[model samples]
Target chain A: MAHPQPPESDPQSPSAPTAPAKSPRVGLFVTCLVDMFRPSIGFATLKLLEDAGCTVVVPAAQTCCGQPAFNSGDNKDTRAIATQVIEAFEGLDYVVAPSGSCAGMIREHYPELFADDPAMAQRAQHVAKRTYELTSFLVDVLGVTKVDAAMAGTVTYHDSCSGLRELEVKVQPRRLLAGVSGLSLTELPGAEVCCGFGGTFCVKYPEISDKMVTNKAEEIVATGADTLLAGDLGCLLNMAGKLKRLGAETKVRHVAEVLAGMTDTPAIGDPAASLPNKER
Target chain B: MQSTSRNFKDNAHKALNDATLQRALLNVKSGFQENRARTVAGLPEFERLRDAGRDIKNHVLANLDFYLERFEENVTANGGHVHWCRTPAEAREKILEICKRREAKTVTKGKSMVAEEIGLNDYLEENGVEPIETDLGEYIIQLRHEPPSHIIAPAIHVTREQIAVDFRREHSDLDPNRRLEEPRDFTDEARAKLRDKYFAADVGITGANFLIAETGSTVIVTNEGNGDMTQLLGKAHVVIASLEKIVPTLEDASTILRLLARSATGQEMSVYTSFSTGPRRSEDRDGPEEFHVVLLDNGRSAMLGTEFQDMLRCIRCAACMNHCPVYEAVGGHAYGWVYPGPMGSVLTPSLIGVEEAGHLPNASTFCGRCESVCPMRIPLPKMMRHYRQREFEKGLSPQKARAGLSVWSYVATRPKLYRLATRLASGLLGRLGKVKGRLTTLPLAGGWTSVRDMPAPEGKTFHDLYRDRQAAKGGRE
Candidate 1:
């Protein structure tokens, strides 16, 4: 599969020879789902970036990436959301994201979204050029081939559609997973296919989404892997939701959380996890 | 083919519950998907050929009027007639007129999507001309009184048991009790049954895959040889095709043909690739005497120079449908018309207005698999999004969805309100779901939780966590 290495199509491939004189300043685009559902992924991503010598900051003004609006053909809303995002991260040297869906929207769709407005388009193009998915940034820009992380089971990876197709993050996550100690990576059949968590699509067409995830669960179970890992939490939660419903005990976590060796917390969709304190 | 396209949700619901249809769809899911991947992997030049194919179709489209005229001139010179029709009604009437002129009581047909596009079979049957389907897949669906589910495999939704029953009911003259469990058995029976219809029919009706302007030849590729027999045996041969089927030369046709079967069925070449120019010469013994072509425009001309012109490049390979998870789940009948899958989603609304077929485009997950496997590299998901945009702009989408999106857009633009709203919602939902790690159900989210549980959020947002961490590392040198 020629994975676990930067593809030749990387936007930053020309000058990968030497490390920078200063730690690169980064603005983490905490995607809406990660901000709401699983904050551990954000911490794991920040730790990995910091470990790789990045000066990371989370922009306070950041919100959604406008993917839901853009995908549903609400271009007006999409432009507004995109403008807010572009403004929030414009001062940084890099904007990295943990979810492929959000990262891909910035990297691939932002320029197109702002194409008519010349100044906004220029800023968008710059933001897109500087944007990278978390794993791809660590391996491609930071040149970190290995990580100090450990896991106990045979884990299979699901390549979320947006990341694999739009950002070409197929090999980056695989590369990081290979460095985890005591972890055997078994390739899941049809791993590159979607898990039917296409944001609004799952709820819009539940039957079709259910059928797609059901097939995905069957393939996951067939691999006999005890744990499932993927970069995007949307796909992980969708697959995890189905896996738990089907009564399979397979643990599901973001590739970042596992690769950061922070698996002490319960799996993202595990029903057995204890609730947070009410009087914080 | 009546358009129940508007009732797609209902159609899909029925299709999902039909066990027979589900079993029949398995062949399309496994056989076509696996074979196409293997064949595409073997050809390194597949992507290049897709570019070539797209360029050829684009060139023809740019000069479509010129190519059609040149093709007509060539056809006339070759002792053939070309009937240019702007609508399906005109094409059907012209075809019937020619058949009645030849006193054709029976018409043998090769598989043609344009034929389906015009609803030719029902029109002919209503006017007292018998149309006998010659393609194996088309023949099976024809006997069952159904429109084709899949374009290439017309009877993709019909099971072996259903076909056996259909044959036993229709072909009373044949042996009543022969074992019809095997696919080969069904194929043998169809071949034997359709064999006589070819010779007995007075007119042959077939669709052209490509029409060459240089030679005035109409080409059709099929795994079955019935097309050749249909054209040769009948007294008059009628080729019905859309206007976009015209190409400049034979070389362009062959270049596109290289991508055709490999994408359609993963075969290096179809069993038969027949090119007919006019009719047989005076010296020929076994060819039809009259040759005519019906060129139907329908709505293709409207698509040119629009956001949809790229769709003219489609060669009806069905690769997009074969690999689509949505199509695999509910099958082609759910799409509710002549076309299905990613290609159908884009092309249907373009042909039959988006107001009627809005759901087709929205049905996709935008998985990008269709574009990945497409032989012509059609940006299917992008076009589907275009349809959604049009539907939204026209206010054709459901009122509830529009209202929800409006509210979301309003809140999302105001970052403060968006933060406050999400924080409160997440805090309440988090506390509720923290005990269980997931939510079995939630208000207005039953569409999601009806099928699977929704994962609970962590107590704090990433922004909140990041702020806390930064405070702890305050004033770091």
Candidate 2:
């Protein structure tokens, strides 16, 4: 596991010529949903970060970020799972996640989880400060606008509710994708609109959920894009499920997967067969 | 006289029958949402702007009384008058008195929702004063004698064809043989007619987007330029609005304006961003002779300390309604109130008691999309839940729903009983599932079955499957 370090420039020194330190160690907090259900995203994050010349590590003990429980008002279960997560990744130069919902849980609510304990709150803040969405981590911290990853397809991005609103993860991803050699970033009509996958909301109220996802699917098809890209796996899965059910051929892939040169490996199950034709 | 409430089934039935309204709604299905996203994408610091917008509203709301006093003083200092009204009747009376004093006969209004809340047009009409709606959307709804379906786009439920018919019937002076061919044609005709009213009217009534305390200016943003022309050409200009519209400084106003335009219409700025500081400066030749600001309280001052204080952060963007599935299904009129959509679901019940609007809260699937897109970042779903709880506590929900909820609550308190009940129900449902894979309708669950099919439950519940699987795997059983 990697631990995020303080910037090398001295806080005490008023005037000093400072050299930007070597790319700090960054551990990919591949969310539990992506790790268990969508392993390609994890591999993509690793490839993208490593390609950028940074030390990368994947902490094995990282589980669910307790978002499912927290959103359900089960504070106790959320705290229990969150504690396990913090303990597992106690030292990391930067704990980064590809999903906006997981990143928000780590950054926004982790402090509340440890509100009773001051030391735990401080530790949670440390993790929160270092944790960044995949695109934000790459663009803001690493200052890398372009990556070697290339693919050919028209893609529109879905702004996951947590990422777009909670963490403001809109531009960083677009900037990175814009720099990619051949990919075209088309705007989905109502792209900032929620896909209506409110975690438990999809199950509890499936009727209304059906209407929302169907609307989203219609909008995605309207964009005339062959692929859908988003930072959060939850939104992608919801959209993908709807698209598949509707028999639409639009494929869903995490933004990290597209940027990591993993397009050659088919995203769903076959890594070798998934690569773009040019890469293969 | 509480005609505001409608039975949930009745509202849905009414909306379903309105084919013309559905056509109109389809035209604007994702209109605002697309525009807002496009506008936000253009600004690099959009999120920072949103945060600042939220903070500014929060600050003004916290010190509302002080700001109101300061605004009142500034308006008075600028040769303008400020009238404080605690109720709708007071607001109506104040406006009437001002009209009576000025001996104003014909008045032109520039699309004010606050005016609708006070029944201002009706009051003026009873007193023999004519009020004309200037905005194209508002004009159609006015001619048709209907309340605004959507707040900003008042006559959103009326189709272009319907408007053409309305204009033909009302504008008898037009050629009876000529056909209304296009929207541009209808708009040009309306523009020609409304231009006359803009100049001929003695007073112009408009709503303020924000009341700036620093310079005592009332800011109005309009795309059609009606608000600008109304204030600039009329003899007297009146702003009958809420106290929550007051902001402390122009900088804060600009920050809000940045978010408001993008959030509402996806415009970098409205076509006419008119700031009327006490009607017009003395040197200004073409401006109203008298200016009046009516700070309306009605039920807002009481909401300041309540759970709904966050609602005051709303800039009337209607982004929530645009993305809401329920709003898409039933349209705005089904809410049976001035405001509609997620914001309306929470607000309608608050303003008109729980008994009158018990169904509004349940109208949502609790999708939480409204909260996500809200520039102010209000927790809309939770506030809606508060309304739902209030309705349930007051015994406003239907008897069957209440009974069903009680049964579930009883089962929830006892885990063993819950498992038994679920197991028995699922087994019966599984047997029924063999006949057809789903139930098209269910007795006593008319609301759920009306819109969709209920999938047949599996023979075993999650608890039962979890226990059996764990035992097979040599884990906890």
Candidate 3:
């Protein structure tokens, strides 16, 4: 593994104008779901960043993005958790999350949460400007259009609500996926609609959530795709769980796992040996 | 109307199980949304028009008192009566008084959500007056003795087959074996039946799309010509509008009108965009002898300066409900009020107490399709969240939900405890589901597991793995 040069040695730094420009330093906000349920996504994100000639660090103090509290209308606790996140991820060149929902929270909502405290509000605004979803960082900020990875499967992508509406992460992932070899993309009907995994909403109103996810599952299965892919883990989990319950043979995985060519792990919610590695 | 919003969960469950309503709801997903999308695509400046509409409403709201007074002055100058009402009971009483004065045995009515808000028809019927719905959809629902299911399409929950059955049940005077298979057949039969009611009606009641302060004119846009007949053929014409419907001028009204029909029914313009300033003049041909405007406050004045003030900008286009996935799934009646869907989720709690309608705001998935499609650019989800905050502050949210949230927040804010708890839980669950990589049932998560399986965690926390990976890499170069 390659290590990034110290900040003082970077040519872009005012202190050392003669030295070569160092790689961009990125702090990975491995969301809580990814940290526990699927560490493979975090590793995949790290590999993608490293392969793009960037230095990636997983900030140890980061836990969750505080969305679960914020969406539940517990703004007081949300502010405290956001304060901790700001303190941990400060001073990095950029903050990137493999999940758009978390990145959207940091980028779109953190500043709104600190509207009363002007000093904290300013710090939050700074951090918010530097935060980007992984695919967005790769395509929009890093300007990398292609990846050195491939997989053989027909997959449909589900655009999660927060990422699609709040952060506008529609074409970034699709643009990168166009570069992968042997992976055909099928369009899912009503792909932009929510799969009803609204943090606490699924459990709070399970019947409504079940109806919405069932509609989404029928649409996904109608496309006849062998695999399902999305950026956010919450939607992926909700969709995968429903697909499994319906006894569909469709495989589910995070887009990063496929983009980074890490298909050795089993597909989400499937039996351990259900899928064999077929990367070409 | 008596609100059953407190029973939103039960209503939603019943609606989900209702087979006919489920089939009728398919029309909303396929018809209005696709039509609006196509119509909006033809107009490149639809978004800019939305901004204009929002700004116009905001300006009027900022100077609401001024425009309202100006409107009242103009109405009085035009030989019209303006009655200010602060409550539904007052508005209903005022309309009843007008009917009593005119000795109106029957009144023909256009589709008015404000009328529904005040429960005017039932109140009139109880007071020995008959209120006949002139709009085709409203007429069908009236025959069935049901409230309007949708704001624009009042009978969207009723299918043509059901309507035919209703007609056969109610219209025993008609031929018992007549064909009623097509929509045109229903329309022709309804038109013939309502023609007599329009002539017999002593008073007309209709809702205003806009109350123009400049011209003292009340506007009603309808695809059917029934609204024109309802106000024209009757002896008196009455317009029932809420306070927020007052716009500054006709130009402002026209600008908002550009977005209304396209948002509501996806038409460039409705078939009849009729405006009535006052009663008929001495030399006039066909017009009402009296004109009255009942301006109802009905808990709207309190929303003018608060976080919910943006909700007052709604034009009632039904776009929010048309695009809402929740409304699409459960249909409109599940909301259990005159207003339904995303707008109802915010406004129901404001009009009715949040305690009575707490489930309305909590039921959404925050998909944001409503806010995206709203012609007036209302931040509906944000307003819904504000209602949630109110519920949270008042301790009106479910006790179990609040307790779970507090416990989770307590653990989440402390990273060390969170990591330890997650590690132990994931390791245990990982072992329990080592074969399938998913759990068929979870102990405490029955809400999730009852409907769908829960995927097991991948054995260890990323923090634990990363720390070990760093130690193996010689302690982070």
Candidate 3's iRMSD: 1.1
Q: RMSD of each candidate?
A: 3.6, 8.7, 2.7
- In model 1, residue pairs whose N, Cα or C atoms come closer than 3 Å (at least 3 residues apart or on different chains), thus clashing, are none
Clash counts for all predictions? 0, 16, 0
On a 0 to 100 scale, what is the lDDT of residue B284 in model 3?
91
What does candidate 1's lDDT look like per residue over B1-477, in tens digits? 578789888888888888888888789767998888788889999889999998999899899999999999999998999999999999999999999999889999999999999999999999999999999889988888889988899988888888889999998887977889998998899999888888899999999899999999999999989889988899999999998888899999999999999999999789999999998888877788999999999999999999899888888899999888889889988898889999999999999989889999999888898988887778999899989888888888889988999999898888778888878877888888887788888899998889888888876777666667777888231
DockQ, all candidates in order: 0.61, 0.07, 0.71
Model 3 lDDT per residue over B136-213, tens place: 999999999999889999999999899999999998798988999998999999999999999999999999999999
Structural RMSD, model 1: 3.6
lDDT value for model 3? 0.90
**Error in Å for residue A133 of model 2:** 16
| DockQ of candidate model 1 | 0.61
**Model 2 chain B poorest 10 in a row by lDDT:** B447-456
Better of 1 and 2 by TM-score: 1
Give the native contact fraction of candidate 2: 0.04
Error of 3 at A101 (Å): 1.3
Provide i-RMS per model in Å.
Answer: 1.7, 10.0, 1.1
TM-score, cand. 3? 0.97
Model 1 Cα shift for residue B29 (angstroms): 2.6
Compose the digit string of candidate 2's lDDT tens values, residues B26-74. Answer: 8556577678878899999988888888999999899998888899889
